[model samples]
Target: MDIREDLRDVSGQIARLLALSNVFAENNKYWAHLKNDEDFNRVYRIPEKDRYKVESIYADGRDMAIYMMDALAEINFNYARYPTLTSIIEGFQNTWVYGNYNKETPDIAKEICSTYDIDLWSVRQMFKLFKDQEKLLAAVRATLAMLQNSNLYKEENGMPTQEKHPHQINLTGINSSSININSDGASAAVNQTYNEPAVFSEIITAIKLQGLDPIIEGELIDNTHMLAAGHKSGTFKDAYIDFMQNVSAHITVFGAFLPALSALL
Candidate 1:
């Protein structure tokens, strides 16, 4: 599973949504000015021909926004196993895309509405949608940064040349202590004082319960198993920390299990 590819796809979707949002916002600007006029009611009355055109424009933008939101939601569901992506996508949906106007409106949306004198609900909603897209884009970019760093380390170290067996590490009577790992003239001492067997068991059980891909499950199991066998490396530690940060960002079903899983680091 190439996580970077998945994130790139998400980024592309958000970019498209942002462009659509900008167009929608621009279109609404004219209506906003009309709303501020003293003769707004007389000028924009339902009987006016221009009123129907404005309504049509508004409906078109609203429908497109709804369609784009649905696409994002579908992507979120498709990547449900990745807690980080799911959490970010769901946050955008809850707080911006479909949040309640009276109670759940984002602070930025409120501020923008006030600043621009935008009293229209649809315009306010567009502002919220645009802001949400921006925030989610930032999150995805940050996650990609972490993933890229890990990938670069793996490439340079030529680590995991082949998939290791879950039982590859011998765990007979190994005491808890720090181990020095050296690769290509680079070295680091990483602490390995935790109970490896117990931690490995917890990770395996959690992965199985989550029904992750067999390849992913195997990789995770082998890494944990290696750590338990006292093969602690800086690269693995960094990857472990990155995973933990992503998981901890948003509370999910895996929240309770994170602390136990993190002990492997």
Candidate 2:
């Protein structure tokens, strides 16, 4: 499998989860089936495959897998997003077409109609003359190119300012849920603990599995510039917050690595 492609797909899920984690939208199925573990699993299951891949860091240990699940389930994230909506869309326009805009590249109809006072019949005729007529008649769509980007990195000491930013790095691991066990003799509840050491080990192994050097990744993250909304018109804090949020979604894979992301540091 292409690692970058996989990462890009994973990144989209993180973005959605970041938006839905605390959502109260009545129609959202995430909350609708949340009480039914099976249903919740169904809705959130697409990325579970990726989680299984990450679980390889544990080398197929059932206990480690259990711990990993517990750790993920317990996390309450202070999520952030990167390449803000503005930046990602801008990047799309810039790259998708020379501009190479996929959808934004204006259609012949729009460009020509704007300059002429032509009637509907004339407009239809004009379109018939254009080659690749189907493309010329296609609907407007945002390429959203930033979604495929697998290039993300961070550097030491260059982290965004502490007070203004949410705890992007200083994650909190709290086991807020519990599982009930019923044995022949008795029933018991267990509080899953966040095993920092285990999580740290897994993170290192998982990153390496991508064939990336953490040291180089750190540098790349620090120096890289992806599109982020609000940066052009907003304060540094706003831009940083947007980038960090996107990063949160990019790395978390729903809930597997979050809260324990503190282990990354």
Candidate 3:
């Protein structure tokens, strides 16, 4: 098998799991199916199968394989929460496309055999080789650990902080919903504009056009940017609290893994 290609495919799953872990927080929840919500309809396909089973080695009883899986699962779980793993998974998933099979043409199997020097039967075995959890999990874990320990999150640091500005505005609840203008005249008029029923983009544009400086704030969430100029803004502490409440969904998957093992056997 193309070791690198197979490794890459397994790594994709690990990254996905880490992302879920980060969001789920607790191990039990991270393994569950809470993420099966309709909002997660987006699907990512992994890289193509580059190598056949002819050169593949059995991964059973290999410590490396287990270590890899452990590492990958940790990373995948984190990404689900922090989104770092999600971005990495997206990168790997978008990098390759699987091959297509055709049977209508005469000697189709022979043609493939001639080019790849392997028959359809061997190709089937190659695919099965990847099904082994030991190898797949190990490969995933290794990739996850590499990404988790990377400098992306900053190894030694507290919570991530945004750029610190010297000047600060303490407008009392100038949120989009209820803008309380402490001043009269133009300030009140501007505050009213903020409460207008305009789209977020339009409001931002208007604020930029105005002579007074305005700021658009929100959390840079996974694969999305949220506007926090109003009541929409939230604290990470709240997010973590909410995450812990639903962490069990992710953990349930581990129990199901045993059934998968049985089926493979």
Best candidate per lDDT, number? Answer: 1
- Worst lDDT run of 10 residues, candidate 3, spans 217-226
List per-candidate RMSD values in Å: 19.2, 23.3, 21.2
User: What value of lDDT does candidate 3 attain over all alpha carbons?
Assistant: 0.28
TM-score to native of every candidate shown: 0.25, 0.17, 0.20
Query: What shift in Å separates residue 101 of candidate 1 from its native position after superposition?
Result: 26
Q: For each candidate, what is the lDDT?
A: 0.39, 0.28, 0.28
Where is the poorest 10-residue window by lDDT in model 1? 164-173
lDDT for each residue of candidate 3 in 37-127, tens digit (9 for 90 to 100): 2221121111125222122221211222333334434443444423553354333332111111121122332344445554344333323
Native-to-model Cα distance after best TM-score fit, residue 91 in candidate 1, in Å: 26
Q: What is the lDDT ranking, best to worst? A: 1, 2, 3
lDDT of 2 by residue, 1-265 (tens): 1222323433432332222221212112322233233222322222443333322212222222232223222222311322233333233243212123233222433343344432333223223222111111110111122233323211122434233232232234556432111112221111232122354335434545564467544322321221111111112232233334544533532256544432222
The parts of candidate 2 lying over 4 Å away from their true place are 1-196, 211-249, 259-265
- Kindly indicate the candidate among 1 and 2 with the higher lDDT: 1
Clashes of each: 0, 13, 35
Mark the regions of model 3 whose C-alpha exceeds 4 Å error after superposition.
1-15, 19-53, 57-67, 74-118, 122-152, 155-160, 163-265
lDDT of 1 by residue, 1-265 (tens): 1224445533433333333333334434534453454333332333343344334433443443454445434443445533454444444443323432222233533454455454555545444444433333333333333333343334445654334232111111224333222123322244434222354456557767777678655444443333332213233443343344444422353455545443433
